[model samples]
Target: MTPTIPTRQPCPPGACICERERLVEIQGADLRILYLTRQEEKRLLDRLESLSSLSDLEHMQRRMFEQLGLRVTIVPSLNEVRSMRGIGINIDELPGLCRKTRQAIPAAIRRGLEKRPEIAYELLNANDLLRDA
Candidate 1:
């Protein structure tokens, strides 16, 4: 019996060859993930609505992208993440990421406190805030 080889599909019409190349390059970069808090998401949405100047909007987007530990040049904004998803990258894995992070939090917190006691204080304060609410 012979094994079948999968065929490569031709690029879609009107799509830039450079974009496919860019996606190939991005797949190799260190995966930087962001799980934004509700407050941060609200702030970004507000900024998205309020920014009228192109330069200002671009600046804010770059800042937000960097804050999320993503490459600003490769991913200029959250909107670009959605665009990447449309192109077939499996980036919508936040829920899975969150589940894994939650499972590892105890060990992470222990290591973090040993390295920096400030993290312990911050964690307690965060817990208190959540508990109070």
Candidate 2:
């Protein structure tokens, strides 16, 4: 007995491509690999691993996108991710992380703007004004 394969849903009107599993394709300009999560990643990996030539990889990437219902997301620079590995923090922690980093900077350097001295003075006055009120 043979297992039945699922049929793809028709592409939505006004959209160039059908949405599959909420998948969208993002391609990195230089990277040869398709970087996606879960089953899509698995399908692409299996296809890539079996390829014996560069042309085969290129053809397979295109074919996989069409047949497997996977989408791509392009990374502008993979270089940006190189230093960010294993820092197990979620998206919500980023702003607080940025604030902590700002706080860690040397106070003198952070304050060293000759053109912005008036702004600094204004901030200082505002602190005192708030304290008095």
Mind giving the per-residue lDDT tens digits that candidate 2 earns over 6-122? 333333454432233233233322111123323444454455444444344336545644643233221112222222121112212211112322232222212232223443334
Minimal lDDT window, size 10, model 2: 87-96
Each model's backbone clash number: 0, 10
lDDT of each: 0.36, 0.32
The true-versus-predicted C-alpha distance at residue 129 of model 2, in Å, is 58
Error of 2 at 26 (Å): 22
TM-score of each: 0.29, 0.25
Where is model 2 more than 4 Å wrong at Cα? Answer: 1-44, 72-133
The global Cα lDDT (0 to 1) of model 2 is 0.32
